[model samples]
Target: MSAFLAPIHSWLFNKVLLFQDIEMDLRNKYLEIYGEEAREIIEETKNYGELIDRTKSIEELIDLSNIHGWLQNKIQNGESRVAVILSIFIDKYGSDALKTAEDIFYNNGIKQGQMAKEKENPQNAKDIFSTLNNYILEGMPCDRVQKLIQADEHIVRWINTSCVHRGNFERANADINLFYKLRFLYLKGFVSSANEEYKFFETNNEDDYIYNIEKA
Candidate 1:
């Protein structure tokens, strides 16, 4: 099953031995799980995309329990491919519901590393975190940090719990996207809010465990 689904990990997202065998081979795999007639119907389907949509809906056809566990697992293994799939899924579903940031956004995300490099900071993310942590530590920068509290679009959704979400702590790529959004807080509030200095980052620490949608 893993091998059969391997192509899906690619941005190409699918693989086939031959044009004629494309539907047949995939159907054969599905048959092993869903039965012969289902396989036949899939093979006969006119549109490969329609068949794919249907196949995804069948719990018996696709082992979602396993898939769900591995849904965001691509970063640790096939990062580029996983990011591709994540981007596709987010494009279709919209990022409004996902609190942190999904793999899709991460696959093609902002380059904090590049930005930090441009800013001459070797550790931009770490620097941003330290700044915020210091703000908490000193208690002298409440207004300064508050100006930095530009919540991400998914921040509210992440806390809602009813929403499906993703972010950096979830995956490296997603983290970048979240950071990109959080960085905006500085743009929106920092320079304008108070007479203080706080480095800008793409994301803020939401006072929760790492990747906790409850606090994103």
Candidate 2:
């Protein structure tokens, strides 16, 4: 009886250990595949929620302004891939990633401008603008940066004719006012440091935005 019981016990113990090992491997593989997908979903979902809230708050402004119908529709569409990328960065590196990236771009722009100022033959406005542009491009993926540049051109156009949007913006209580102010301040700082006045004007050509630099 003792011999029979010993064999039975040994078989049961080995099977239990094998089952545990299989379970552990399955858990690890599941995490390996699903973990990244889970994180992406979380960030995308959060960005969607934030964008929806922002759109809701600014709906009145959108309705009142001279903004293009396509732009209004786009904003209302709630399909901001930039927001998702930003959210991923924030999740992995913490919210401070935003400030850090901004500082990198801003400080480099200032440094380039200052270096130009110190030289007897300072860099021209076009060169300075290129430096600032490169700084921004360095911190983002190329495709995303291209999209940003296009959006920025639109924003510059809007601000150049700000009379169209100012009243609606003022009444809507939107945070875009901060962006409007910051653009002027940023350009002003570049102009001051580089010892140049860069003037942007609309043109009749296909690529309508052009800038002229003058001695300060």
**41 in model 2: Cα distance from truth in Å?**
28
Q: Which residues of candidate 2, in runs, are more than 4 Å off?
A: 1-112, 115-122, 136-174, 196-212
Give the clashing residue pairs of candidate 2, or none: none
Q: Write the per-residue lDDT of candidate 1 for residues 58-125, one digit (tens) a residue.
A: 23444455642333332222332223333433344355423223222221112222332344332332
lDDT at position 27, candidate 1 = 37
In terms of lDDT, model 1 sits at 0.29
The global C-alpha lDDT for each of the candidates, from Candidate 1 onward, is 0.29, 0.35
| lDDT of model 2 at position 99 | 48
Lowest lDDT 10-residue stretch of candidate 1? 134-143
Q: Residue 12: error of model 1 in Å? A: 39
Count of backbone clashes, every candidate in sequence: 9, 0
Provide the lDDT at 161 for model 1: 20
TM-score of every candidate relative to the true structure = 0.18, 0.28
